[model samples]
Target: MNEELNARLLELLARIEPLLPPEQAPIDWSRDVAAIWQRHALGGRLTAVAPRDGVRVEELVGIDHQKQALLDNTRAFLRGRPANHALLWGARGTGKSSLIRALLNDLGDEGLRLIQVDRHDLVGLPTLVQSLRGSDYRFVVYCDDLSFEGSDDAYKALKSVLDGTLTGPPDNVLLYATSNRRHLLPERMADNSDTRIEGGEIHHGDAVEEKISLSDRFGLWLSFYPFDQSTYLAACRHWVAHLGGRFDTDAEAAARRFALERGVRSGRAAWQFAISWVGRQ
Candidate 1:
């Protein structure tokens, strides 16, 4: 009877073993320059990905001041000098995310690597950082479209990774995040109701303080704004020419009409127009 029960247990164990998640394969950092953080029941892993192509730093227009500032900081970081984690915040489709991607394409040959992490997957940031601590390549852990609702707690993990914990982020790694929200958190009217003046100084409520603290952790803050008429047309011309389209007088009029229909002129809108105009020709 004991041997019969043992046989049944062995059969069950064999079936369960095949259903378990496999151990993650080690990334070849020497060859791959990018990855995405993927979380699972058994912790998390970095899945290697091919770097995106066709975005060059020179092609980005109208945000030259922001482009140069981030470039200087990144150059300093690659040279092993003191640099701060950067936060790029502002209007949607305003080239905030493009600048980061362009930075990677510009400096990739200089040992700069990128690892993209979703805002929801930030809870595993410490683990991800730990894994990259020993790597020789400098990593930019990018989080795109990062914003949090009032009830979300994942920001706590990101806060700890940024500056809260004693371990802190390693020297070989820096974080670059882009968000449409300047504060990265939703603000409620009630949150401002508790403000008061004391000693001739205004004090923010605890709720406001909590929201500001996260953005404050980033030492470098870059702001992006909506493009004006001349800037928007310039961007359209650049992309249209790059995409093998002629940006003549008629094309300029069409681009303006396109922007009017969309109700906002941005780098993304310009690119979309370029594609449409070029494809139609």
Candidate 2:
């Protein structure tokens, strides 16, 4: 009876051995357009961004210069040359985040992978970076609409990753963040008022310095401002043309009315107008 039991245990062990290897396998990063990372108490999880749902790079308009600069920076990183962690800062509805997504789509085939890390999940930066380190692909750890509030210490992890790390940022990765505030914080008249007098000279408060320093960490700063009338209309025309020239009516006049009603002129506003315009016809 003892010999028969030992043989049965060995047979079960052999069947279970095959399943163990697969459980320990590394993540399959090759099959997706992008990954949205969320941290849990146990570990991090990645949700794939399907290619069908991704926006193409060419879909953007009226910001060709900004787009080209970002593309060039991305290309430099892809080639293993020196590159800077970039910050896209400017007004709302100006396509700051859209440009980054578009760049990722444009370069997805070249082994450029994008991992979107949420602003709240920034505390998990070390873990996220560790996972991407020594990987075969180049990664853009992106943070959209990143900002900080009063004494909000969440920016610390990102600050260290940006430039303060002892070993510096990982060679295989780069950070691309988009923010409405150039300083990554909303300025308050009170924060600046609390100044120190050192040797009878007034200096800014630590709180102000802390906010400014965070933005300083980024090596590349790209600004996106609101568009003018002609530029906004031009963008509308481009989008209309790309959508197979489907609009029978004058898209320019309609776009101008939309921009006026919205009280904002930006690439995002133009895209919104185009969508609504197309839907109506």
Question: How far is each candidate from the true structure, as Cα RMSD in Å?
Answer: 4.0, 6.9
Q: Which regions in candidate 1 have their CA more than 4 angstroms from the true location?
A: 1-24, 195-204
Q: Please, what are the lDDT tens digits per residue for candidate 2 over residues 1-281? A: 99999999999989877754233334577776588888765567667766444676667776778888899999999999999899999989888888888887789888899889998888888788877889889999999999888667889999998888788778989999999889988787666576555334365576568878989999899998899998888777766666655544577778888999999998878777777887776
lDDT of each: 0.90, 0.82
Residue 132 lDDT in candidate 2: 80
Clashing pairs in 1: none
Candidate 2 off by > 4 Å: 1-26, 52-55, 194-204, 246-249
Minimum summed lDDT over a 10-residue window in model 1 is located at: 195-204
